[model samples]
Target: MIKTPSLREHIPKTFADIPETTAYEAGYLVTKNAGWRNVRPVIDKDKCIGCLQCYLYCPEGVIAKDGGKVKIDYDFCKGCGICKKMCKPDAIRMEAEKH
Candidate 1:
């Protein structure tokens, strides 16, 4: 059986627990940057083919496989549309952030 690590396991316990990263890096580490997002990606599960294209192209590495489907971790997602663009099935779409 394939074992997947729970998202909780990756949460940082404190400020010191956050991994050090360079500004040049494309993604954030366990930090909730949703406040900075102007748009967010919403996945249509029914249209998803589970091809992993979105997962592979997500620059923030926020896309994950969930039971043969794909999910985006909005906390770290920077609202980039790479996932939606890479989604061949048109499963992902970007919408304006409500807040």
Candidate 2:
């Protein structure tokens, strides 16, 4: 009879011991290359009320307070969609980044 490995035995002891990339990682790379574009937060100046809500909620620090309105740094943004979700005025919208 075949036996399945226990969950405890399947986990790695240390982070370094784990493989550099897993199958999921490879799949993500494939999807990313195949136009699985990331979402970037775009702030509509007219809709934005200069509340800094997006800047405060962005965990990635991609949102910055510029003068009074908020601006997103697309280069560092991971497209987590948090900023858009947290916007009180719905000023932020997630748009697909062009590759």
Candidate 3:
């Protein structure tokens, strides 16, 4: 049996305060808002070694291999900071998006 982490394990308890109905209705709203204001991963091309480590480690599938560099999809990036943490060459850095 493959084990998958629970949503509650990843989402903070504060999110539970949202009523189920509102939560359902606001899911897209939340995602849209996150895209507008959440921190985004910026790749320093010169620092990247073309190792593809960030592409393999992003949980949100935000990182994409672009030729010899990596690109981040801000629309889907949740700012989890995992890519920054996993980059072997320390090429990825998190920067807050201007709201």
Name the top lDDT candidate: 1
- Candidate 1 per-residue C-alpha lDDT over 1-99 given as tens digits, one digit per residue, 9 for 90 to 100: 999999999996753454332122434354566689999999999999877777767787777666777677777788979988898889888999988
34-85 in candidate 2: lDDT tens per residue? Answer: 2343777788898988766666677755565555566765545678888788
Predicted candidate 3 versus true structure: per-residue lDDT over 29-70, tens digit per residue: 444534444687788999988666666667765566566566
Off-target runs (Cα >4 Å) in candidate 1 are: 1-30
Task: Sort the predicted structures by lDDT, highest score first.
Answer: 1, 3, 2
Compared with the true structure, model 3 gives a TM-score of: 0.61
**Quick one: ranking by TM-score, best first?**
1, 3, 2
lDDT of 2 at 70: 66
Q: Model 1: what TM-score? A: 0.69
Residue 84 C-alpha lDDT in model 2: 85
TM-score of each: 0.69, 0.59, 0.61
Model 1, residue 32: C-alpha shift (Å):
1.6
Q: Give the clashing pairs for model 1.
A: none
Spell out the clash pairs found in candidate 2.
none
Better of 1 and 3 by TM-score: 1
Global local distance difference test of model 1: 0.75
Lowest lDDT sum, 10 consecutive residues, model 2, at 21-30
